[model samples]
Target: MPPSRQPGFENTRSNEYWFCFSSPNVESHLIISISENHYLALAKGPLVEDHVLIVPVEHMPSTLSLSSEFEVELCQFQNSLQRYCKSQGKEVIFLEWVFIRATHANLQAIPIPSSKAVIVEKAFNLASQKMGFKFVSKNFDSISDGRKFLKTQADEESSLSYAEISGGIILLHHVEEKVRFLAQFGCEVGI
Candidate 1:
């Protein structure tokens, strides 16, 4: 039998549903910046004020499956967002839900007050307990190191979700293909 279909992409092979980034007619105000491989845009139905998304220009399933050139540009956009948020007394937490057949890979950048940053890890830990999963935690000295670790931990065949927290720490949970997953898990945890 063929592999099981990912929930949202069974009948779709295009990025039309995620139109804010893919649409040529995207609202100028919703877009923050565009780069060679990605676009930083305000998210639709944001979970918090100033929530944004970093999406690839090309249709792809996961950032981990992309090239280093793509990773470099993505890191640049991430850094820019972090800087902007920091200037506003906030820090960013970047999240991604990688699946076997997602229509497009996008990173959700959520800004929280720097004062509340300490509680983020604790919240995720509690959430994991309630959600019946464990997050394998790791620390990195830079974005490249964190990204590299994630790349090695999962691939196109693996379903996982991760949060690139401020200060070079990342928490990743490998989602068993057989288990029911909350696609918005990272966002829910953040909220």
Candidate 2:
């Protein structure tokens, strides 16, 4: 069999999807590139202030959809974004909303007050507790980084995790659909 096309890209070429940063037609200002595998770029939008999108060259649907190696590559770019923003005295919140599984994936990286980073973590953890599951938190200190962590622990049974990396720590938690109530289904839910 021919190599299977990723879930979202089975019927379309990269140019057909506006969010495919890897496409030559995407006029988004190039920022930093990691390899043919991924790149970080400034997407065209009002959230242009310190807002970056970590995009994979392949058309994966979500972070959870990525294989161990892709996940590691994605996190490496995220780690780079985190450290650079920190050095500039700015903070970033990296997140992905993937309700629609047929489009390319772009992890949004936005800056916020350094102090509010803790508040964001508390809000997610508290939300998880409300849903009756403690946030499955992990720190990469024991390992080299997220790739190592996921390679050792992640599996198919893993639920979708919303990550908030702050203060050099990465916290993963489930997005409770019950709490996701009262909003239009998709991106309107707001991060």
Candidate 3:
């Protein structure tokens, strides 16, 4: 028999699959597009109403081995989505680029109030490091015509994040822990 179909991709004739990220209790607001190969899905998470997940079409064992193009495209799309959210007056918390051991690679864009950028960044950095991931900072605003470039990347990826999806719950919890840890350090987090 051919490979067993994933729940959402039951119809072989379809190129896109629309379904909830994980739990229906989360409101099922997020949407995802599964790749033709069924190896990846571009998911929009709903952690803060404006989250996005850039997932790989294939289930990679580790994120450290992803293609350079895939990584770049993921980040670029994330930046564009954040810009769009900002234009809509939505708050952006932080972006979560996650690599699950058993599934595809995913990049989640979480929206938080602008006032919480610094706090969220610091918390994410600390939490990511604690999780054995290296932290690198990229100046997204410094890129030339950044939004356009990112939009192009998004099209290439063919994915979007939405409200009520919790695809990146693990990373979200990590961020929450970091925020709590920062609060314990006497930092007032206003998100």
lDDT of 1 at 2: 19
| Tens-digit lDDT string for candidate 3 (123-158) | 645755674553333333422233233333332112
Candidate of highest lDDT: 1
lDDT of 2 by residue, 8-98 (tens): 4544567666557656667664555656577787756735377777877777655556776777677677777777888877677766554
For candidate 3, which ten residues in a row score worst on lDDT? 161-170
Clashing residue pairs for model 2: none
RMSD per candidate (Å) reads 3.2, 5.4, 11.4
The model with the greater TM-score, 2 or 3, is 2
Name the weakest run of 10 consecutive residues (lDDT summed) in model 2. 181-190
Q: What is the C-alpha local distance difference test score of each model?
A: 0.82, 0.58, 0.37
Query: TM-scores across all candidates?
Result: 0.88, 0.62, 0.42
Q: What is the lDDT ranking, best to worst?
A: 1, 2, 3
Question: C-alpha displacement of 44 in model 3, angstroms?
Answer: 8.4
